[model samples]
Target: MRQRRWFPPLALAVGLFAINVVARLIIRLGFDGNDAASGRASIIMFAVIGLTMAVWTFLACQRKRPSDWLLPDLVVGAIAALLLTVLVGPFISGGEPFKDGAGDFFAQIWLYAGFAIVGTLLGYWLAVLLGRDYRSRALKAFAERSKSKPRKVVRR
Candidate 1:
C-alpha cells in the first residue's frame, strides 16, 4: 500500500471549511434579523455542504480506487466541516456554542448528516448515469476496446 498524501485531504478540508464560511456569512447577512429565516438559512447551509460532498464523491470516483478517497475524504471532510459549523460558527455569530440547549445542537448534527448522505447519493448516482464514474467508465472502455482485438494463442 502507498502512503497517503496529506495535501489532497488538506485541500479538501480547506475547501469544506470555505464552504461553511460562505454559508455562514450568507445566513448572517441575509437572515440575521429573523430567527425563522436564520433557521432556514442554516438548513440551506447544510444542504450546500451535502451538495459539496456529493460533487466531491463523484470526482473522487474518477480515480483507480474510488473507495480509497471516498471514505476517508468524506469522513475527514465531514468532521472538519461539522466542527467548524458547530464550534466556530456560533462564536462568529455571537453566541455560546451550547447555549441554545442540547436539543438544538443535536438537531444541527442530524440535519448536517442527513444532507451529506442525500448529497452523496445524488452525486454517485449522477456519475453512474453519465458513465463518468471511475470504475464504471474504465471497465466500459476496457470492454469496448477488448472486443476490437483478435485473441492470439501461443505455445508454451
Candidate 2:
C-alpha cells in the first residue's frame, strides 16, 4: 500500500493563510481609515474562504470514499491556516491582535471556525443529497457488479 501524501493539505493551508494575509493587507493599507470598506472587505474574505472550503470538500468527496482522510485533512489544514492568520498575519499588517484587544481576536477566531464548519457541513450534506457520498457510490458499484454477473441456471 502506498502512503498518503500531505502536500495537498499543506498547500491548502498555505493558500488559506495567504488569503488572510491579503485581506489584512487590504484593510491595513487600502482602507486604513474607512471602517465601512474594511468591514466589507473582511466579509468578502470570509465568504471566499467558506466557498473555497465548500468547493474543495465537494470535489474531494466525489473523488474519494469517506473512509479516506479527506475530512481529517480538511480539519488539520483549516487549523493550520487559522493559526497562521491569527498569529502571524497581523504582524505583516503592522498590528498585534492582542494589543488591539481580546474582543477582536476572539471575533476573528469565531468567524473563521464558523465559516469552516458551515462550509464543511453544507458540502457533505449536499453531496449526500445528490447521491454522491461514499455509501451511494459503494451501492452503485455493488448493483452494477451484481447485474454484470452471469446468473446461475436453476429450475424449480
Best by TM-score: 2
Q: Tell me the number of clashing residue pairs for each predicted model.
A: 0, 0
The whole-model lDDT of each prediction reads 0.78, 0.84
Alpha-carbon shift of residue 76 in model 2 (angstroms): 0.7
| Candidate 1, 60-132: lDDT as tens digits | 7777466677667767777777777787877767676799899988888888778888888888898888988
RMSD of each: 3.1, 2.8
Across 33-150, the per-residue lDDT of candidate 2 in tens digits comes to 8999988998888888888888878877887876674666788889999999889988988987787798999999999989887887788888889988777888999999999999
What TM-score would each prediction reach against the true structure?
A: 0.85, 0.87
| Candidate 2 Cα outliers beyond 4 Å, as residue runs | 1-4, 150-156
* Candidate 1 Cα outliers beyond 4 Å, as residue runs: 1-4, 153-156
lDDT of 1: 0.78
Task: Score candidate 2 by lDDT.
Answer: 0.84
